[model samples]
Target chain A: MGLVAVTWMNCLGRCLPQKTRFLHTLKGRQSDQILMSPSLASLDLPDTWTPNSSCQSIPDIRKSFNEQTPTVIDGKLMATEIRSKIADQVRQMKKCLGKVPGLAVILVGQRRDSLTYVHNKIIACEEVGMKSVVTELPTDCADADVQNAVMRFNKDPSIHGILVQLPLPQHLDEEKILDALCLEKDVDGFHPLNMGNLSLRGREPLFIPCTPKACIELLIRSGVKIMGKKAVVIGRSNIVGLPTSLLLQRHHATVTIVHAFTENPEQITSEAEIVVSAAGVPSLVRGNWIKSGATVIDVGTSPVEDPSSEDGYRLVGDVCFEEVKKVASVITPVPGGVGPMTVTMLLVNTLDSAKRMLNFT
Target chain B: MGLVAVTWMNCLGRCLPQKTRFLHTLKGRQSDQILMSPSLASLDLPDTWTPNSSCQSIPDIRKSFNEQTPTVIDGKLMATEIRSKIADQVRQMKKCLGKVPGLAVILVGQRRDSLTYVHNKIIACEEVGMKSVVTELPTDCADADVQNAVMRFNKDPSIHGILVQLPLPQHLDEEKILDALCLEKDVDGFHPLNMGNLSLRGREPLFIPCTPKACIELLIRSGVKIMGKKAVVIGRSNIVGLPTSLLLQRHHATVTIVHAFTENPEQITSEAEIVVSAAGVPSLVRGNWIKSGATVIDVGTSPVEDPSSEDGYRLVGDVCFEEVKKVASVITPVPGGVGPMTVTMLLVNTLDSAKRMLNFT
Candidate 1:
């Protein structure tokens, strides 16, 4: 048929020349070149704002927009370089699958801040070499003792990850012990089908809830750039502000949230560029609810009785970190920020649920 | 103990007097009295802005904010008064349980707009007395012939809502025939555990997706006071702009969204008071992206090529409706807007999944 429409117009002119040079560099560009093209920070974007084909490039988006000072993201040095590369991939999957990753926990009572967050998640699952259990219970337990300790760690085949330790004891039911877990060892993604496949858009959420995956792994290991910016969040809680505003609209930004019946929450967090907060309600984000450069994060902690330390009480967050680290460009800090990356993203979601239950990739 | 701290300060002076008159009517008021107290229209609000104790009162929120002229929002006369009140509740559940609500539908190829949307959802389940089937298949069927027609209406006990009809032809497997339908007969809520319990917060979503439950039942049957207002939404599309921005943040507003990597989306939808749009991109929301007493709700249609009338092309939507009915004060009209309230919210989610599978309530 006329040589298949001239060979399909020369195979769509070689598969559409990089989407016609990314729509001819977004024609007559200037909305400050699509807000300095941090991949056009989105909420549900993706209509051709290519930007050196993803993952920041134009000189690292002009050195994160001409950096001047602020920065401080750290999150305990990116959770010690992501728990030292998940403890060298759990010592190379226990030297080729002799079995490594486990992580159970149930801990119904003993609230000394939930026994120091279950002893710092059993010392971060034995410093990443993995395998750690728990159970605990008492302090007037019984909702069938926390769903029989979550159905015995969901029939523990060397428990790939379970976790229960939340604010469990007010005559316990806690959504019937988090609906007796086992949505493949939930890993604390707070299963409602893993928060509905982390708020669906080509669904994919096996586990994401470690303080909103340590606030998007401290904004992608601090290179920042959450596509088309303007975030916000603050707090909606269901474990850290509604899955960190559904993981900042799956890293396409343009989020918003705000909370506590947002009357003017500092004029919607002073028109954010990325805020977060997670209002546990201490400072409740201040420094004129920032916007000067914005990055923030905070994830609110809230203890506050201090009487000059020595365990009288300390903690505090929801930003006001020295007045939002002087108009934030990037901030983090409350007691080594996002609290040691929420126990290093629960040992990286229990070594990715033991490499997807030992298939070990 | 000092007369028991004076009888616990006279029982905390009679249980904190309506939270001290809702925090003394929110101290120095003005932030336009908490955005004119439509129950502090929120995204996550709820700290205490009592507003005549909920559900619109202040003279119907000042007569829907001093109405002027625009108010269209008919949705085909609210889908014929919600399909005549779902045909008088499916004829009072077929005179108390003789059984009526069925609604199956599978429909595979002959794509004349998926056979006119499974022939208008089998003529709106036989104009609501209910029971309607339709299978169709063939366009080179097999993905186990559309997952055995969704496991024969998930083992039909006279099926209580099934539905498959979406763009299903290009080599079948639409998410494994929608994960082999039957999360309590899904009734098209596009289950990700019912969109993770409709974006969690005291979860609850057995079914919702009929065009975001007819755009939140035409803004709560037109009273239109989605708490703490600021909305926006444009498009995210997991069927109607991410479940109508998670049902307008579960009716607490403060949303945002804006898509196609929004740069200024008309300066964030002209600082929204509730926008909606759904970007099936026809006119794509203009009239300075509204906000003069906004409340838009387009839900785009997009047909275009009109050779004037029938089968030539007509549809249209995504707002331009005579330039957003001159700066919206409440608009809708795109072929009687939101397409007959998405088939009257699929016959009110097939009579609420046959009154939740005959437990009948």
Candidate 2:
């Protein structure tokens, strides 16, 4: 593994541009210099270097990175464009068919994040000329009660799409409740049928899960050429990583997935032309781990302390942004990036569901 | 790719015993010395060679191999054992419940291989004490006629399982016919709802597709040690390869699927500790492409011409048996391997279906 890592670093140094080459060389020189500094050389060392020695080089590296250029993906703007197209289609459908698309959101409990997400979805629905209905259940609601709610929505003619916010109360069976949603009405595409259909050759589901779809859309709209490119998706969570890898494969990308148990994730990530980091651990993806000029989609939204913020909290993506922005050619910012696109895709799915159900062109 | 192949051959040679080593060297010496003795010097070849390259070296190789013998897993015996268990359960169920589990097989047109396969399935059902019904449709049968046959089987109270042999005459809508089968009686597990249910993390379908289930069973029964192992499934066909890979992953194997159009499949397959080849392409898997001592489940059954056989044909698996058997620790023979076990699993699924529906355990 160490040999592979060294070989890959050498390869990258040789392959990158002059500016990136200088930075990488300087970073390496400084790190080696710090290790051989007077204070470090005087002390007995363990098998591995200590945090203090590692930290000695960080301040200088941070100063250098701060002056580096930032490459933005403009996810919010791209999402808005997609939403407007969907809104226009919805308006045309309503005008010709005399009916508006409807989305039914089932919220089991009041997880703040879930509440906020649902609220954003409702706003997006309204923005897209679709009707939104919220069915909120108490925290102590029984599994049967939630299932019945889904069943009601499944039978309702007006409800073209249904979404049950995930991480349901511990007592309820998540799989059973989700499976109860009709395949056509399952806008989230978490249902196994949709996934199976997606995995099959020559088959496409009525709806693809939003986050993955949005990730691809964002990349394509940003002019990232994907055909025959190498993509590494770090994480294997069903909702994000695995499906995203499959979607990329569908578009002819050679995708390798690096999960938590993977032997050497950094090496794999560095080999990819496109990297999608969904591992929720903050700052897990470092700048050096990324290939220069590669597009990074940071899907992780970790809440970290920020004294400058009004709430003393800030949402940081999985990538160490300060460092990664210097290396990545294009990257999606944590708050304004994948989050908005996800909500927008949900609106599109709901509208599509309605159009399909009503046979509205 | 060439370097990897050379490394694999060296590893195989080094891993073998002194006798095997001697045999290989002897064969090389004899082939070059005896068969090409006059031409050896002229051809600029080594003097050490043999006529029967492999055969001449076997005795000494076998002696050394015996000293450091690897565990041999008998897939044929294990499959038969599983079938016997299913047969015993079916017998007990029939006696106690007073109703034998029934499987209805719908065969469209007369593809020779399909006919032989369906016939074998019927025989397997009878051997397991389950009722088997075959509905054969003419090659020119209308789509509606096929659908009508499926509907009849779906409506039959005695039938607990329904399976339509694939590649139904090109004119038939395969998806529609598959979807029409009652979800409860979809023993093949191809129904969209069942597939959807199977894809969820915690959700288990009433019936998993037979061949994939058989692959898992073969691995478990052989004590192949799949947990956390890197598995590569070659092919992504819905029926065999894709579902089998997913099932392996569910059992904690880190699975990589190499399908058609996948670049450098040899590199990927060689890295996998366990290989499942179901590409239906004969001799597609080479011995050098497999990791040392890997377990290979060959699910392909392509019939090739053989003048020696009464039928003027012989069945061959996807793996080149002559070459792969020398390297693979355990491998399934084409006809007796996954094929028999697949039919046995179908019986088990039918019986389970009956048990679930009748509530007669």
Candidate 3:
């Protein structure tokens, strides 16, 4: 027994050397880039802080930190890269299995916004070499019609992902319909189980909501280190703000959420190293609300009247972009920013679901 | 059409009155007595700030703010109040249903801690007019032995709740065993679905974890207005910290969680109006760590060596109670604090589960 204990101790001594390991995690669809930490300009952090082995290292985290010219986080370029990679995967899968991934959408109304969202998703699916199916029902259709559509898609072997265009006529119970989707095909990541997993530290969500996923992916690809950063999320909407806050928390960032009744919103946002605004109020966030070196991701897509535009209106974000850009180290543009990434992430989730179904992982 | 629109407008005008309504939400089993907010003494916030009609009115919130004599939150007294109420209900339930609620506990090992816990729970059950059953297995018992016991209890009609004491023998699969228990009998609130529902905004969890429930109930009954207040929860343990954070968020408090990786813990806690410490690190938090008017709930019950004491050891919480009592407007004592509330809350959950099973709310 003494000899065995010595042998075990010797084995542990050799195997568990106190070596420092630099860990880098590239997560979600936009798994590639993160822009920089503005204040880390001198590269002093690497020498001063030797974190534990489990820490996720951000490559070139300070590449543009505290630079005179801010590093613009180009979401459009990153989305294109993710799309191409997904497209390549789709091609390979089709060749190997003689089958293509399919995404099915159940739309209840012909509301212009909902129609536009579905069209974008279908387009995104087609771009990635995946098949798309749409089940359109009248706005006045009963809740049973929507549930039947979801059930059909859930049963179909080809349909790996199911999406029910939300704000499904006020008459229908949204929670009931969403909860009914099979856990395997719930690519929206809004199911209570997926959300619970997301919120819990050890649990993992099957799919992260498209908008928040895009925001996190963009941050990762841009090279932002979320660990230990003070992050403030504006708005507590279930889809965007809530999930984004949870995702940030999972990344080890101390996250605070401020909403309608919160006192002194600007003070909170201005103190954060990372600010994600999804308040849906046009131009609510101004330059003064941002910290000098903060990375800001704008998820708001509110329409503001613009007399100069041909359509007499233009899409603006929660942040007053032009002014905030001057103060912020990196900021996502509204039209060219989170919008394209949201559509792209949906395609990514569908492809992932399809891959899992095919034992591809 | 114009006449009908005018009539409809007039009808809407009468239907939506601008009168204020107070909403007091008493959630989960530990439903009464959260002591006072300490710093509300000098200010009559109600007269000064009549918020929107949707605000909840917490009576006498400003009773002893910054007083020389700090408001000591008596958890022992509050727990007694909750237990008696539960006892009365259990009596009424037994009278009506001709059967009493039963709680079945599966204890795998004869560890001193586990034995004491089970003994206490059995005592609590008896005190509340409920039946208790303990399935004791030897230390060397196989995983199947525990699983079978849980399965048996799940099928038993009398058993309304099932609790498998945690930290089961190292050889066992904890997650799998806990997940196997029937979710309906998951009165401990550890099931993934219940946890998931608890994390989600609109969904309701079957049961809130006992410690957090007691903490919230203590705050509510004691009259600390949670809505819009800044709260910082130190520790992110699944059972205590994470669920408590979610509960606070649901109650509209702006919450920040400081965990193992968080830098400047004191700075973060000092900023909060409410601090709930569950770090399980004895004497980790001192008086200087707390803000002048903050309400402190200490959930840490770590045993420390005390040669002077009769037992040669004493249970100390994360906060240095003596020091913190001087600074915090209201604070819970270690022995009489969260400990009693936790056991009382378990009984509350069991009774609630039984009531629910019997078609009573």
Candidate 4:
């Protein structure tokens, strides 16, 4: 990790490429600035890892930031409370309307991670006393096969929320399949119209993406003031960074998004009062890279090797947790923080969809 | 104006209503902070009014900013160049295919502003040697009336673009009318699907919102470096601020939007390297509010009283032009800056829509 930090510093100091005349079709920065420095947290370091010198002494820097703000945002507790509320709502709905909410998920491939996600979604539905079904297809399934399943779910009156698991077969048209789902049943909120409505001021999306929704929920529950503060969102993926940035701006935080193409990502993050790192890169954001006393929401959940652990692999966020925890006023832990909240939001969206569809609103 | 400013400040200082928890439905900022201060330049002082004490000495401040950057972005010149290119394209299409691209606008009401806008758009089309049509309906027209006109144009091959003038009658459903237009013919980019496409990654909107496109074109043509630079957009209106902020993000500018609900907006703007003021307030931004070397693109065009002028009302932007000029590296003038570029972009969208339909590209 120390060697990587030194190498990263040397790279940042190097002179950039020559300039060119401005043109109409210019897509990116003309300067030869190197973007997307390799994340240092994923490095195979000895168990006795010493902190980088320039990034050291968090306790000394702690005095400079708001020492009063020692609150560590407890996401796991919040998720449990929300889930209880959902379960109660489900019980009341069953008693009054004689029906419970239903969710249908379409899993296209046999990827182990995707199967796990689908299984967890089913379990969440069951926890709330809701009916859930998963339509599994082989890895080599055609686009038509996925579309037919989604259409069946869309037509099923019992299924109020329809979710199509991501990373479909390479040959499948992801956009077409996602677009085919009925707008009312698109609980995952990946539909284009839903995304558009999310962006427009007066127009509201039928559903909010789970991950971004979870991040905002954590911020609000933790009493993180976003109004008029400088915010930096790493990564620009449609599912996380882009929508998260939009939500931050709507929440009145002045937002800056740093992605793979962004130069000086760390410098930008340091200026932010609120940092939401969604970039999948492990340890991309170091402790020194965060603003003192700033609220850090680590959304990245990449698995990193840990020889000392029984599993030999541990989940980590984009932030260097141990280092950032010392400086940040509040930070979300990887496994317990954003992860559980995402599942809860998905369930919440599904329930809301059911309420709207069943005229229980 | 002085009375209004004092009243606005008093309102800002008052404690806001609270106790509402941040739920999924909570859309905007909770706390309010005084964002804009009265622009000293707009004060009804003598012609020889001096600068504010804190903002005195332009030369001393000039040295603090980049000395070589004396570029004032001339939108009129750039517009002329772009129109010429469009005209050339139009002529080529006419000669090669023996057909000209046509645009159809549906105006539902007789609002004077709407009339003027439609007239200007038609004139813009004519100037580029393209065909144009306007379907003006009574103010009391039903939603079906607007829908029928849009449907007719959607089927007309000659009519490659369809635009619905906004601010329909109180009884008319604006969303219904917009959604009724064919996606391919949505030249205004207001259709939820088109907007969704614009907001989503990897999905291309049939049209880019004209004003946002113009602002980006001006930035690119003027050689403004957006990458890794902090940018502030002053407004959150769907037509301007929201889309402009999105475009700035797409251009790799670290974008922050300061809306009416924002706190300490001047301080936020002062941190920006590029400022796009789209708030339709006259002289809401002052000299001290701007960063020394920032590029200011004023999108606001509110009419302000000017007793001495030939017209009782004169147009002004959100920025206090004379004062911001001294501090900003580049500034766009109100009458010529973003206005012409907006009309040009409408034409460009129409031409692009035509080219797509005619297989010109």
The TM-scores, one per candidate, come to 0.34, 0.77, 0.84, 0.77
Worst 10 contiguous positions by lDDT, candidate 2 chain A: A34-43
Fnat of each prediction, in sequence: 0.42, 0.20, 0.33, 0.36
Best by TM-score: 3
Residue B101 error, candidate 2, Å: 1.7
Interface RMSD of 1: 14.0
Candidate 1, residues A55-151, lDDT tens digits: the string is 2211211122344578888788767777877888888888997888888888876777777778988987898788898978787978987898789
lDDT of 2 by residue, A1-361 (tens): 1221232233223334566534433433432121111111111111110111111111111112233465787778877877777878887877898788899999999876677789989999888889989999998999899999999999999899999998789999887798799989999989887887666555677778989878877776666755446678876666887678767766545566665544345655665678998877777888766777788999987677788987577788888787778887888998899999888878877876887899876
DockQ of each: 0.15, 0.09, 0.24, 0.14
Of candidate 3 chain B, the 10-residue stretch with the lowest lDDT total is B38-47
Instruction: Provide the lowest-lDDT 10-residue window in model 2 chain B.
Output: B34-43
Top candidate, metric DockQ: 3
True-vs-predicted CA distance for residue B350, candidate 4, Å: 0.9
lDDT of 4 at A58: 19
Extract clashing residue pairs from model 4: none
User: For model 4, what is the error of residue B148's alpha carbon versus the real structure, in angstroms, after optimal superposition?
Assistant: 4.5
Report lDDT (Cα) of residue B254, candidate 2. Answer: 58
For candidate 4, lDDT tens digit of each residue in A212-248?
A: 8888778766766664567889887778988888777
lDDT of 1 by residue, B247-350 (tens): 77766667878776655666677678778888777776777667677889888776767777777777778777786676678888888877788887887877
In candidate 2, how many Å is residue B261 off? 1.7
